[model samples]
Target: MSTRPAAGRCLVDLSAQDRLRSRAPERAPMLRVLCCPPAGAAAGYWRFLVREDVHVLGAQYPGRESRFREPAAPTVEALAAEAAAAVAAAPWARAAITPGASADVPLVVLGHSMGASVAAELASRLEHREGIRVALLALSAKTAPGTAEVASTGAGTGAGSDEDLREGLDPLAPGADAAMVRWLRRLGGTPEAVLEHPELLALQLPALRADLRVSMAYDRFPAPVGAPLLLLRGTEDVTVDPGGLEAWRPVSTGPVQRREYPGGHHPLADHGDRLLEDLLACAASGRSG
Candidate 1:
């Protein structure tokens, strides 16, 4: 099959507010979670986190899903800017972040893999630029930005990800690009059957390639922020080691906490329920708003 997406695949765009509004607006959210999807993913990836008392806002990156027609974010900073702008406009930001503020909604910014880096940057903007307080900045499955280990390994750069798609394909099966396939497998977030299904995988390649390019080319690392941090990693995840998670400590002036799950790169795939339970516990302390 051709790698090009089908014609009916949309090319229009929406304002960030309309494209990525709160999952539930009527309820007074006990906590607000602004999430960034991992490389190759879209807003739907965080659907599991939606709850009646929680407001989930998954920043929908361009060039995928509903925004498939728009240009993909050129860099991590640009994506963070978009998310910052969107969340800054929300009504929740008006809530005071000071201790004991009555209306303050506990805000958390979360992302996994390349999204983790983007989330950190977004959290920085929310706190430093928007004058908002992010109760928790959660980074999952990625090393701290600007860490020497990342430079040494080309982690998140999509480097060394492309291998032969032609080498082992059956004679009758159609050929597809292999770079995304390899990267998805490397990240361990996607299922094996989906990785092998070229047509479906190809449909996701445009956005995936764009996000990988952003990760590979980004220059800015998040400046240290005052917010507390939550670092999540899979115990067996080769993509991010213990040192990488620990590196995040220096990026925050407040408490830096870590949680390990039982899996490889995609620990959340099996443990999102557990993660939500933990986040609820996290919010309890920050609820004073």
Candidate 2:
């Protein structure tokens, strides 16, 4: 468990002007999808994913983007708690259940890499505490918790020197001082200009390291989540082995399905249409569940 900030302040507060951004607002949305970005990324990563039926809201973590001044969340639990609260208090949540509107507008949660673990915890919190039933819990490029432990005990704990941090990112990127650049190239969402600036990279390190620490140290929840789970993986993803994806089957009480795309790790970039189709189908099923 990592140290939490004082009350009334959090690393990522959706209520803040820049934390939770709407990607598709031109048309009325039948469902709302809250997306969490991969490690070292921000909410703007989902800007390209526009759909009329689904309103995409990106969750912006602190120590990046507009919240660069705020301290990053020390643990995944803390980040999840804050995110859950923000969702519960969001205007969209209220509009979804307003009278004369749709009976039950679905709320889908999607995440990638470290974001996947955070989404799991957020879904659990929302279901248990806020009585909000998530339509779908979609995860990508991440192994199920409690099955395979992320190497958090040693040098990968985010406490090592800058060189160690660069080395740890080698698998995801595989280069030297260009660690951030390589990672962006592989992730396929971040802007090239952001990676090119040394000042921005310096500002991003704390949040990235904190995210890594929480992800590495995360433990599986004691109980299975109630929402249907969909696992997406890339055929070429070296970070998450295909064998470990099946572990998600036992972690959800609802239906569990796994699919592999043609690319590696970042399926949304290479297979956005297929991903969107599957996501919409899953949300429809959740509405009828």
Candidate 3:
């Protein structure tokens, strides 16, 4: 998928201090958010989601950005396990839940499209293995994990043609393939420069292929997630149809929240403001912690 921030928001570099924590830098985040980016994405792909009490920690999949030299994860479970460690080390991780008492803060995970699978797997680890209570699990633009096939309405659905991923392409090629770029454009969310620029495109391809491979093959951990669930879908999104959004019903044991927008596959690009609004609501009300 092609990605760029919509005009409503600006990209925030995690390496630098973020305005999201400017108001309450000293206070441990009342809610810690781990947002997994979709295929062909890296950690910093999340646009700034501002809230004084909330902080979004971008999930860093290997083979991209600072992790460029690291090997890409082999399965959705691998990505989840890596992210689980990061969440367990959050500043409030220890402070939130006491020996027998309830948590003081919420641990929230959000993912869109293929990343949604990663988010679900990560939530399972936190709730079942780490014993960390997940306050919320937000999934957007994807069918429920374990569904056999993708929605027929989506463009280029299923695992995708192997050629579309451009695996093992010339590292020094002058540019990316035009037809592949066009296909990606149809998928939505990728930036134009990334689609057209050779060097940037090359850096994104390997991770994209790996992510898609696992994401397409992934199924839920067979344990129902205990976190409150939030399913966000755009009415116009071809990637996930209405029936697909409804498929998340039996995936969770806690309360479930479903919301619809008037956009497409990339909610952050056009509807990030509303998405944050829903997240804020979920954080306050879904406090199983």
On lDDT, the candidate that comes out on top is: 1
lDDT, candidate 1, 6-52, per-residue tens: 22232111222332475334556677777788877887678777666
Error of 1 at 243 (Å): 0.4
Q: Which runs in model 1 stand beyond 4 Å of their true positions?
A: 1-26, 96-101, 150-176, 286-289
TM-score for model 3? 0.81
Off by over 4 Å in 3: 1-16, 19-30, 99-103, 148-158, 161-176
Q: Can you write out model 3's per-residue Cα lDDT over 146-181, one digit (the tens) per residue? A: 454453322223454434344223334444355457
Per-residue error for 222 in candidate 2, Å, reads: 5.5
What lDDT is obtained when candidate 3 is compared to the true structure? Answer: 0.67
Model 2: how far residue 83 lies from native, Å: 0.8
TM-score of each candidate structure, all chains considered together: 0.79, 0.77, 0.81
Better of 1 and 2 by TM-score: 1
| Root-mean-square deviation (CA) per prediction | 7.0, 5.9, 6.7
- Pick the winner on lDDT between candidates 1 and 3: 1
Residue 209 lDDT (model 3): 64
